[model samples]
Target: MKKLLQIIIGLGFILTPFYTNAHVKWFTEVAPKKESIENILSPLFMGLALLAAVVLASLTIIIPKMAQMPLIKKWDDYLSGFRKYSRYLLKYGTAVALIIQVTNGTLFAPEFQLDSTLLTVLAWVTIGLLLVPHHIATKLGASILLILFIMVTVKHGIFYMLDYGFYVAIIGVLLVGSTKLENVGFPFLYLGTGLSLCWVAVEKWVYPTMSLDIVANHQVPTFGFEPAAFIVMAAFVEFVVGYLLVVGILNRVLGFVVTTIFILTTMLFGFTEIIGHFMIHIVLIIFIIEGVSFYNPPIKMHKTRVDQFIFIFLNFIFVLSTFVLIYYRFA
Candidate 1:
């Protein structure tokens, strides 16, 4: 009954603003012709959002049960071996990158439509340096490259480089055989994700205009509710979710749920449509890593009723936000 009540409340939150439809203008995007709503919101985005909600809801319900199942526990043992394999793959990956660098420069030129620029050349050079007979020089070269890469990532806007920088850094770690460092990376990983998510929610809130416009012009509605209300709701939900994510509260479940939404987002927005599907794959990798963490659970994280309440509350908020956005756009 408690869970049912929570779901009901969440549905209500999602559905109420949907009836108002006062903020369709928020979703519009400026285009070459003019501000076309169609240009702002695509079917892919909408479908992805809906699909994410569904998948998250399912996972939230199922994963716990799976955790309890004897078969699932056995399966996790086999899955654990992948981490060791991942370490081996990382070493070989440098070789692959080396091959690609050579091929890209020699065979696939500008004529071949591959980017064979200075950075590509440098990347290959570093890879070769890592392969030398001298372990000290190899490790030193790789470490320097890793440091340079991190410096570049931090110096630039976190949002601009975060996605790609994260992938590169992860690859570097794997290549260098830093499994021990995974312990150190865990807290920072949580901190970074939490901060990013919180910031995203805040950005949408502050610039409700951009996010809301995307909703309106794209023809995604808020269950017939006024646009302003929906925008407010969205801002609030994102803020709350972001806060929770950053603080590392309810991280496991939230991580799973958020990943689902991100996956849907990639499918709808076009991995290549936004920044390229590469980031999407990176996100998937992050999700997998998180799943592995949960399975092995190097650290023990205890849950409280407060955590459950927050999860249910946030879920409710998104449900209402979605329903409202849809109702206004359609009905």
Candidate 2:
């Protein structure tokens, strides 16, 4: 067991440099070109997909037992104590992200510039409401944030705005946090953000050229793999992160690793990286603090190890195929 933990940690250290969370579309001018279906279904892609499914399924089965270890349990308990502050962290962190966007003349992300004066004013108003310290004010702030999102959708099509779906989830978190159903907010947050990330990972497969272009433009290290292969591995890494979030596995540990990877990217991508991922960083911190306290993860329902493994393996394949095919068809 100790050896297994060491191997996982070692692999994480090796892969950390390649695990980029920056949305390629935000950094590159993506052409309308799509990867050939043949390439999408290549041996390499399918093999990696299967490998990822097996690895994640194994984690889903193993992580519960690992969590019961004296050291892990103690650390998790310490982190779980901060669950009460999850809402505050999300709220204020979003406030800071909005402030950065407003100052930079953008909306939800750096790519979507503020195209009109109304959006600029609304952005400021949303920030003000977020700062007001009252539940009503925060709800109003979330409402305005929704309005801003809709406005962006109107300007750009729904397809473009889907990349920012996590913002909608954030708004949901804020709105629900003030209601009697506040407990549901975190699970909703988890679902929305997780699905959003999974959706975005599809883009890397469908539009590999964009990611490859970003790698070339930014001189990102590939660590000896071809750029294409690296992108595949990177996308898989991101998809697994999102999947674990949805299933509530390794909440704090995943949060810590992903947060570290994002911070490392800033050294390569600079202020733009920080601006693009600031809200994500905040949400990860919340994950580290909350550690699945309010939710019963799906994998936990299967009592036997064999049942859990089968459930995770099949579930991963279904989700991966569904997402890839749907995104390809749309693209």
On a 0 to 100 scale, what is the lDDT of residue 51 in model 1? 51
Rate residue 97 of model 1 by lDDT.
Answer: 37
lDDT of each: 0.42, 0.81
Task: Please report, as a residue range, the 10-residue window in candidate 1 with the lowest summed lDDT.
Answer: 17-26
Query: Model 2, poorest ten-residue lDDT window?
Result: 11-20
Q: Return the TM-score for each candidate structure.
A: 0.47, 0.91
lDDT of 1 at 310: 46
- Across 106-177, the per-residue lDDT of candidate 2 in tens digits comes to 778788898888989999999999998899999999999999899889988887777778888899989987
Q: List runs of model 2 lying over 4 Å from the truth.
A: 1-20
Model 1: per-residue Cα lDDT over 1-331, one tens digit each: 5543543364334222112111212124532122234432345434444554444334444566667778766655544544433332334334443454345442111111224365555566666765664545455655655654555455554443432333454444543444455454434434444444444343343345665556655555467766756655554444444444333333334554554444443332321222222222333334333443532221123255444444544564464354334333432
Deviating ranges (above 4 Å) for candidate 1: 1-66, 69-81, 85-176, 179-182, 220-257, 271-277, 289-331
Clash pairs detected, candidate 2? none
